[model samples]
Target: MTAAAPSATMRLIEASTMISQGAEAKIYRARLHPPAASSPSDPSAPDGCVLLKHRFAKQYRHPTLDGALTRARVAGEARALVRCLRAGVRVPGVRMVDAAAGVLGIEWVDGASVRALLGGGAEGEVEVEERDDGEEEEGEEEAHEDGAEVALREYGLTPDQVMEMIGAELAKMHRADVVHGDLTTSNMMLRRPSAAQPAAELVLIDFGLAYISTLPEDKAVDLYVLERAFASTHPQSEPLFAGVLNAYAKGMGKDWTPVSRRLDDVRLRGRKRSMVG
Candidate 1:
């Protein structure tokens, strides 16, 4: 007998434009049609475009094991997103889910990544500078800071305000027990401000490695991860991160005391605990 063919969702993913590929999954920008009742006037109406995250099969694992893991991860991510939404966290809404095929569809966000907005170069774009004497350039250090200010102005916010938004959003997520395993500027997005929504909202994305946890250590580690990301990606961002922490404390309220103290301890010991036997 011949082997079974791929499912419709898999076929759709195959036809979609592959936007980004990582070790765990491949992201695609695709248009999906809504249910018949969604738009009666246009029965064949498209459900608008979406960002699809397709978790491909892992070759190393057994077929059954791989399928189980993929489905579990897809389900976990979808659950986390829904939980965040209900908790008033600003994140992309889920549009579709195909756990069997390991495909998850989310609303397409129209703005640039936070990394790009901060002038750290566009998503996936890297710049390598070659110096003859292998020495530092004098004014190069100030270039990103200046560009970031201009970018923030376009969004009607200052660097400090942006940091505050980030902190608040993360605190909201943690309060809901949703731990974003990977926290980086590249994972955050600033949706373009509009008349209806005057403020440029900060959206957290890429929850492939997220889970539910209420531990203070977990929450502190989440903040620490973001702090390190800022230190590495954005130069002269110490004050900006401080602003984020301040806002985070306010959002966390009474719970902030423990997490704040844990954060200091995390910084001292680093991300990983010493594995001394």
Candidate 2:
């Protein structure tokens, strides 16, 4: 849906469009233009557009608990994304936060999800027959960094490359003491730097389920979740996953050893700790 025209106070005036509606929140796309030199400056100096995640009040939840949880999660997500950005991990920058309102505005990314970039799962490819028969296919094929369907048919990137990007980006996030609780392929996006640029980079998003923890166990479990996601979604993902771990190992430096050992143990036992009364 379109937002009304901008008022004096709204940075995102005319910038709001719904992205998704979930049990907890509704996401909106907010267009944030760089302030004209004459406009009043914000400390953040927000330029370009951003994705605004507004956690709506859940009538079903107990008001007190809902308010507390919603506020906590909004803050947690903003904090994690900010930490990842500071760590040089490719994450959307937080431009504004209204924790009480459960609103978090982040850098608007231009790309496709890693899942769509990789041709996997029930999500099918684009119809090739739709193309004009006389028109030749466009340009040299490059690796699809955006997601599955486009990545496979259009970008021509192999599964291994996607895995490597996943590994490296996760490692970077972990090194910053951030743990992405829901480490799924769908949560990550591949960002093309520019239309003319050949290179593309991985961007971690959806921090609503994330938190900060420096513990090796937490980090290992994070990797384990991603590994499980890869194995279940893509066939013959062992070597591809190994490549991710390798890149992660190199990027993690001294912190890699402990987390690596814990990851092996987690693989043997599974994601959760055994419960004993």
Candidate 3:
């Protein structure tokens, strides 16, 4: 007796486990079985499952506008992932794309997020003790260091080494003209080394906000956003970030000078350039 044909995306979604959700999309983990072979003796079976990101419909916006935005964003993200892969950047591979339905399936990464490896917990869900003005308390650096020790042991990486990896990877992406609009630790992952591969690789994910640009200002703002994230989340991350910049400088080669200068200027003025005189 033969079985019915697989429903591809629908079947994958039905069997998938909802992993996470954000304002823009929901992610799931599931097996993306290949289309049935035309020949019985074919030898092209895929090994395993993939991660699916579905940009579900938004009811807040007008129906036509919502549909257009979802389709465009899905296609844009898929294109960015393909561009990064071709540029030798370690990002998840594109497995499937359904822009009409706003679904993208990509290679599943089997590891923890960089934020979790840095002792920030999954999704960096640390409780921020608030001051009178709602700013986080300033004395949590000591506690952060203590937690980081255990986290470092689990991942077998020192704080300096992690910073260096982050910097080098970002430089490569910038060289490829891919600007990751969101450069948070949460968007990066350290893939676990497999039997076939000895060394763990750092991968950048979540390209929904990514775009192609060679502008130094855009690159500077990318680094600035990361710098601010570290300041807020990791407490006393100056030396670590400095190590990142050192590796980044070497990776960026001659292009490092302008980006470094622009980064400084950006720091002084904050992320936004004032429109009014």
For each candidate, give its TM-score against the true structure: 0.87, 0.74, 0.84
In candidate 1, stretches whose alpha carbon ends up further than 4 angstroms from where it belongs are 2-5, 34-47, 122-136, 271-277
Best by lDDT: 1
Q: lDDT per prediction?
A: 0.85, 0.73, 0.82
Candidate 2 lDDT over 1-277, as tens digits, reads 8978644324452356676777777878665555667645542323345778888788988999988988899898988888898899999888888877678888877677776555443344432222466442453122222334345444445567766777789888998889999887778887755555467777889988888898999999999888887765553334567888888998899999999899899987873443421
Q: Runs in model 2 with CA error above 4 Å?
A: 1-15, 33-47, 121-158, 195-198, 236-238, 271-277
Question: What tens-digit string does per-residue lDDT give for candidate 1 at 1-277?
Answer: 9989988898888778898898999999887854445544432223466899999999999999999999999999999999999999999999999999999999887677788777667655643253799654777657757778898887898778888899999989999999999999999999887766788999999999999999999999999999888776775565689888989999999999999899899987873453531
Worst 10 residues of 3 by lDDT: 38-47
TM-score of candidate 3 versus the correct structure, residues matched by position: 0.84
Give lDDT: candidate 3, residue 164: 88
Candidate numbers, best TM-score first, in rank order: 1, 3, 2
C-alpha root-mean-square deviation, candidate 1: 4.4
Report backbone clashes per prediction. 0, 9, 0
The positional error of residue 10 in candidate 1, measured at the CA in angstroms, is: 1.6
Error of 2 at 203 (Å): 0.4
- By lDDT, highest first, what's the ranking? 1, 3, 2
